[model samples]
Target: MNQPHPSEHYPVIIVGGGQAGLSMSYQLQKRDIRHIVFEKNRIGHSWRADRWDSFCLVTPNWQCRLPDFPYQGDDPKGFMLKDEIVEYIEAFARKVDAPIKQGVAVTRVRRGKQDRLEIRTSDGDYTADHVVVATGGYDIPIVPDYAHSLPQRIAQVHSMHYRNPGQLPPGEVLVVGSGQSGVQIMEDLHLAGRKVHLAVGSAPRSPRLYRGRETTEWLYDLGFYDLTVDRHPLGDEARHKTNHYLTGRNGGHEIDLRRFALEGVKLYGSMAGIQGARLEFKPDLRKNLDEADEVYARIRADIDKYIAANRIGAPEEAPFRKVWEPESEPLSVDADEAGITAIVWAIGFRPDYRWIELPVFDGRGHPQFRRGVTDAPGLYFVGLPWLNTWGSGRFLGIAEDTEYLAATIAERSASQRAAA
Candidate 1:
């Protein structure tokens, strides 16, 4: 295959070589469309850079499969470790023969005159009729303002920078979030012989699995995981709240903080603010989790009713039972004595579009797209949270979104050629 010169124009240009980008490339290749991908780093940077050494996908191998490539492994329900996912991505890229310019960081994507899209990267400039931003949303880790006031002796790390339990000092560790990342890290530190304290935050009650199969499979069957932001109104609501879809397929494996507490992990209310060498917390997280659980139950019931009405085979039902709830007590701990020599902010991430000079961004810094099409013709965005539905932005859920965006670009390209 001949590489296009820097001055040459391609039909399509994709930004970010992660799962979403690679997926789009594969689909375009099948259609015999000429496209080039610009990746800031090597493929699977999330699996390589952000994940811990022992990290594995919360979703099993079966559900983690991409569009054309299924995970060919003995353990379908088994978690794919970080390195394993990276290797899978490499193999996928090789199989598709994707035209990727590795080590080229996209500095900006802007609209050129005459409907041409300009992609400026560190290496050189590239022009295309259409540009797809498949960059996932977890790029920027959001650390709160209170972190700066902490004493110099304490170490602070975001979930993005956390690698292993060995990186922290030997003392009680305070994890300042109850999300999946926070719960997983707390469990890891506790098992590694460190005392663990988890600061509870507003979180949805999600099971590790659902019914007899993985939660993702159940969601797929019911078409729950197939929703896009453009198709589902509830998607926007789900994105605003921390309530996540949890399933009951982990067997006896429970990784929630309550399970850790049974294994000696101390739980606290949400962290309020930082004091001198001390952290203050409010004890209302349990109430919040409980309230969130009730809301989830209602939603689940509605889903079940919909499935039954549509004659969808009933998924194995996992009974929900309230286990651990937060208490109403203000908790405080000395930063030095808590053995929490470090703080890992597993709070969340936000999209950063400073380099993107397009006018599609809304006040919240998210691109304004209608089902992946931007106001600017020939510009599109994929892999955004709540892009069109509940699952539009997830790893296993981007195939539909990519397909829609690709079709739109192809149609537009055809129209332009006809006009020309």
Candidate 2:
């Protein structure tokens, strides 16, 4: 290990080495801006470590556009699995020569003593005219507090730690939280011949393909991704909503809870708690499923209208039919009674910004930034959820958002030099 240095300064500093951070570095590098990116681990480490072996990007390959190297593979419409994503990111770093200091973890980002922003890292302290928190959104998997109440006999795990079925115990799996991760993992376990039960939450479900086109293409063509927070009716709710229930495995298909129920996977309401060895839940399964179906219906209606008004012909698609329901109100079951030997928390993730010792965060600990610009001077944010548009947190959206932040940083630098 190298000795720690003190007071080294730069024009800009970016935290994280994921796609967001690399994109910001590329943008700054293009303009000859002196900036450094500090990653707690190696580049693409999060995607490599946090994701399961079967994990693939929900977004299509073509939509993963970086600054210089856009995805131009043979399968533009296909999804890239974990390995491919890491390879693409590594190639981007090599191509751009992004000045990323790997293994340097940022401990604190606060206002410096003078005019610059201060950053304390494992390597050393750094001051910069601008700091881009490009850490991206999925930082930590959010397991509920009540999960600790589960019996010691029942092994518990989060989706982030789950690699395969063999890794779990020798009985049924209880998957909590019905978002993207929950459904995907449940399906993986079910196909592996392990009986699985899922606690369906309120997160909406989306079809992999809407009409003849991929759901992404339909939404992209409809300008849904370009919709800003100001334009959305749900506003912050729309911006901060958990990921919809969808899958990118085996060429993508809908992960309908009702379908899962039909396929022998037990369905229950939102997980309430664990009373000793028993797992408690509500009976809102039908209500929750309806809400998800409603959203899907609205989205399809909009797409149909667009095709009709534009005189564009599209194939008539069959509407999703829900024919299966739980026989009666789901009863609280003892862990062993349900044959559940392991419980997996697929409750999604929340961004970790604990290192930022600043007052710029909201009550929820999200940054107080508008379109990537913060209230504090020289303090900027990029790739945060809905910083500009619906896709702001995505790979393609991060690239676009970072470019804007870089331009803003440059303008501020030029003004400061002029004032000096």
Candidate 3:
């Protein structure tokens, strides 16, 4: 192992150079604060590496608002593709002129001597009066243990590594989970004419358009984007909930698993276990579908009420009708019988903060904080899902969260200078 050089010092050190970290840097620059951002890879690494080729933002481009930068494109209502999204973030990074060190991975962060925080990175050692952890929650791809039970012929890839249908062997593909990524990847495969099977989870559905307007616009008008975790009915539980599944591909539209079923895509309940050559699934296919539809209907109802209350002029549309229903749920599927050659695990990712040696974490390893301000002095967090509001981790609400943390950090720095 290479020895770390003499520790360098900075007034503030930020870990992770994604959207959240970049936004925080922009705020600090506006306040003339001295800070350095450390990124494990180049800027917009996640967007350029993790997402599939057909990926696009589910939200409109108009919501792509950084601190002082907003989407200046003409098609604000249109969703930006994966490449475009990367360019947008890259542009912001250039505009901010952030003092960022790319390809420097922070391996550990712990309390150091003299009441400062020590940051251990691949490059060298450093200490800062204040530290901000901007690493987002999606750090590690999660795969079930049962996946190892499959035969060697069965190829498996996590959603993060999955690029396209051609990346897999030429055979039927099994997609696990019905979250945003799972459903979208399934559609990507189906559109490519691959024989696909899906294990539907309990992720809710979101409407793309209602009353001739984008549903997101309506929701924003209703102040849904401004709803904070504390004020939400489900409280913090809302943070753990899976995001509603929808698609921004080929313009925006709703994703109906029932319609997928109607088009001959095999659908199953939540994956339970794997036995020999058969994959077992819980008999909850019908239940999961029904519940998803219930949420779909509820959202439309809310929009209808909003339209009526505001006396808005909109065309009346027909109520939603079930296009298809499962006659019987299959408990298990024989992998060989179905000619399944590959599996895409889109279940989701787990947060890995093992490097953080501080005691400011919860039982589940989640950081304990009130809108990025932790109980530990000089320790802060940003870019977490639902850190303050529904848009906390998204492009829509990151500016507000980062600005708040910057102000808090600046005030604390001023107070410390006075004391010294």
Candidate 4:
């Protein structure tokens, strides 16, 4: 594609054509809004580049639906593998006829006068009245500084680099971070015949399902997953604590620490430090486990109250009822015996706004925006973690967020047109 002149202007330009970007594009198309999406690679690069060979979305096909495209598959509760998701996203772009310039990597985004944005890219420079940073949140993987001191022999890989069992070395693997990625990686490595030791952390206790239905189904029915940042009282609190949102896996499978125990995946307390070949760990898992249990109990009580107030009937109880049970005991393991050969950091991800030279970011590096409008007028952000809700940044959840953002963009564009 030929590079446009630096002075050329587009009505709207979006960076990073992932799920969030695509969704925003779909909404714009529906509104007959002219926009261009600049993608670093082909559409769905993140899903295509993700290393998990056997990776399946935790959310089922039903919950994976986007704004204009609904997931059409045999299993509503079945997890769509990585490849399937990539194809779905590509198809969505085509179906909506979104104007996408693939393989164009954005180098920097700066605010221009009169609510304009200056976007510098590998292909060329372009100005847009509105810019949506739909880059998504998981662009960067976080590895703690403590990991730097590990012995030369101990291999360390972030979860993003992890593909399948074949990529791991023989013997035990130490999976750090008890988040969904860490737990899932530990499960996969263990199932692949490698001894695994999981380092626990402060993780939210989420039920796999509720009332015999998929947890996602219940959440959708109860409008829990539909929560927006505007309506959620705990949005600031939740955002302050965690940057990631936990979703339920498909096929009614619940992820609980007890399940790891049942599968013989050795669990360890929080990792203190790693020196040479030895990894130091806290002796007690009681405090962390207890805290998680309490949180889960409070969530359960809230759900129960919601059910009673709404008079919702309980369906047939599921076999995975044990997930709802309280944590009974603290589990610990010796890092030496577990044969943790590699430490896979599945901790979490943070925003990389270094390339964005806008003065809209707060002290913590998150963009300053209300809805999708930034302090610099035409500069906008969409698909950011908790941009507008508990689920605003999620797959099915982005529809409402995009609609709101697109309307705001249109309003701003109309006002500009009137002035012109």
Candidate 5:
């Protein structure tokens, strides 16, 4: 009665409660494997926490699929908002009866005695034969170094903390990084009557719908996501590529930065550096705009070629608008002169795996893994960009990757049992 029972160990421990973790848990549960998912916050906390109130799925509703669940709404093509995404994940966890330990944030994951993995969490210590870091590689916000150079009087917030226009200070807003987040927030704030200045950067604008079909349809048919990371033409750039510019506002549409500039959102080229109260920018506004248009044309050309080759019947082509219209004066403007009082860093995120005491990262600090399997025999990572394919980091690809990892875990566990 005086001696306490030993802590029971599980075969696998998953370190996130997002879609990736839940998807993996569903597959493992189906295989009757023993595993536990430890989440820092509640299930789907990432979506519930960081995303703006108006944020919706960049992909269509039908693509939001889990193992045992899928988008079942009447509007299959409609986008799901942030709250709906959280609800879907919560429902998925319940449906699979996922063994999730909510509010248990894993502080460390390192090799323990006998090579078993020890995961230290806020709740308690847990050991597992295999550990899966399903923490979808985008937790750490990536703000530019020059952000600190701005006067401390100006407020700065990353996209993760940004919610609505109301949350921002009542003044001109400067949105850095011209990717999806930057463009969307800039548009929303501008429509809300706030003066927004968007710092132009490397971003590819894609049409929301093309030839009466979702652009996603053409991508799926073209097998764009089927290309493996190792074989992608972008080479190492494949891992750190920025998201293409598109917005779900107004039921999804092309987000044109050039048009935004004409519509009063003062556009500046890539931010060079900060000098006292003046912010300097690289004079590449036209260059960046042309590059984005090139990408758009490439996409359209590819789709049209596919349509012609397949003899696919499609609706009449929608009139394409010019991506740019020259302003009477140079589009470049000074942040301080624009009366900017707030700077929101929409620059993307990087993965924070410092807690993982393992030598399995690439030169870029990304995990070294083929698909989800790491070289560390018992350690694995999931839901990372290009882990297997272009889609590996997305909802449609998570289930596929999870299925493979789950099977691998089950097969390896069986072999271990036999040897024992």
Candidate 6:
């Protein structure tokens, strides 16, 4: 007490308090391991803040499983909305009774003397024998460089900050990037009766329902969720792929850009540049729409093949047909003339590991690791997209990944004890 003790120490430290970290903590407790979880904000902050008001789990409720704490709601097939998702996470955190330090931000993590990791946080300093970086991949919101060129008159906000259509300025809204967030936000605004000019990106689309089953259910039965990243056709590149856009809103439904177009939403190609008050778009509107439809068809076709192979009694359905097409590809639209007063950049996010002063990253600043294990001794990562399989990034597989890490950490701790 007189010396103020050097610094707090633990056998293991987790950098995030999200589902991944909590799951890891649960496993560690079961193994009788001591650890702590540090979170910048309270648990479930991202799900509470980043997502829009209408946000819900894109996957079915049956997949909302945390280590042993599976979804117990009556609607196994219904998607849980924003508040429900937060409550689920908070419930898990409470159930596990994870030793968490909320509101404590980890600013830096570097190697310390004697193979211990020094962690600099807002509250105080600490050290640990092993450190697990459970921070999810979506750290920094990405807005294009041309965003700066946008006139100040037009309000700009990333999709993370967007809450609802009411938050936007009244007028036509130009939504950039047609990924999950982009397409959904566009629908949110369009449903609110706001004029929406969609700058469609190359994100693929998925069918919400097919053959009287959710697309996720069909894919699950097809072993898609269990497909490890290593065995994927894209290999590690699969991690960088954009998720196919769908929705779980109002009992869930497919998000078809063509259908939106038919319903009066003006669709444009990917944004190319900003020229004065005019915004330029690529001439690939048709190409983007067609590619998205191709993905939709491929998914249905795969499901059909699986159904036929198993001789299932699923209803036979007709092939996908184009519902609408653009008559002309408008290359440029003057924002002022279009009455666009706001732009929501749903372009997605990038991981910012600059705070991690470790040499375990690739040329693109992405952490280099096999699953969650890195070459750096006693250092690991979790909660990354495709960390092990397609489900690694979602609630569907966090428990399995966490279990693997807990076992790895336990084995290392045992070996150290034996050597001592």
TM-score of 1: 0.89
Give all TM-scores, in the order shown.
Answer: 0.89, 0.96, 0.98, 0.89, 0.94, 0.97
Candidate 4 structure quality by residue, lDDT tens digits, 69-178: 78977877778888888888888888876788899999988876565778888878888888898987677898888788876666888999999878877767888888
* Alpha carbon lDDT of each predicted model: 0.75, 0.85, 0.92, 0.75, 0.83, 0.92
Q: lDDT (0-100) at residue 317 of candidate 3?
A: 86
**Model 3 global lDDT (CA atoms, 0 to 1):** 0.92
Per-residue lDDT tens digits of candidate 1, residues 1-420? 123754458899999898889889988877778999988888888789888776777766777657778887788777777788898888888876789998999897777756677777887777889889888767789888888899978888898899899998766678888777777787778778888888888876554444444455656667767665546655445455554523222322434455555677777788888986899888686775666567556656756676678877755576676666444455788878766688889888888888778788778887787878989878888887677766666667678778888888778878888999
Query: Cα miss at 75, model 6 (Å)?
Result: 1.0
lDDT, candidate 6, residue 310?
Answer: 98
How many Å off is the CA of 85 in candidate 1?
0.8
Candidate 6 lDDT over 36-148, as tens digits, reads 99999999999998899988888889999999999978998999999999999999998999999999999998998898888999988899999999989898999889889
Return the number of clashes found in candidate 4.
6
Query: What clash pairs does model 6 have?
Result: none
1-420: candidate 2 lDDT, tens digit per residue: 123555889999999888888899989988889999998899989789988889998888988888878995788888899999999988888887788899999998888677778888998888988899877777788888887777788899989899999998898999998888888899899999999988988999777787688888888989988999878888766657877778879878877788778889998889888887899888888888889888878878888898898888788988767778667767588887778899999887887889887788888877777788988898888877788898888877877888899899889899999999
Candidate 2 matches the true fold with a TM-score of 0.96
- Colliding residue pairs in candidate 5: none
lDDT of 3 by residue, 1-420 (tens): 124465889989999999899999999989999999999999999999999999999988999998889996889999999999999999999998899999999998888888888889988888898999999999999999988898888899999999999999999999999999999999999999999999999999988998899998999998888999999999877878999999999888999998999898999999998876788999999899989989999999999999999999998889988898888889998999999999999999989999988889888888888899998889999998899998889998989999999999999999999999
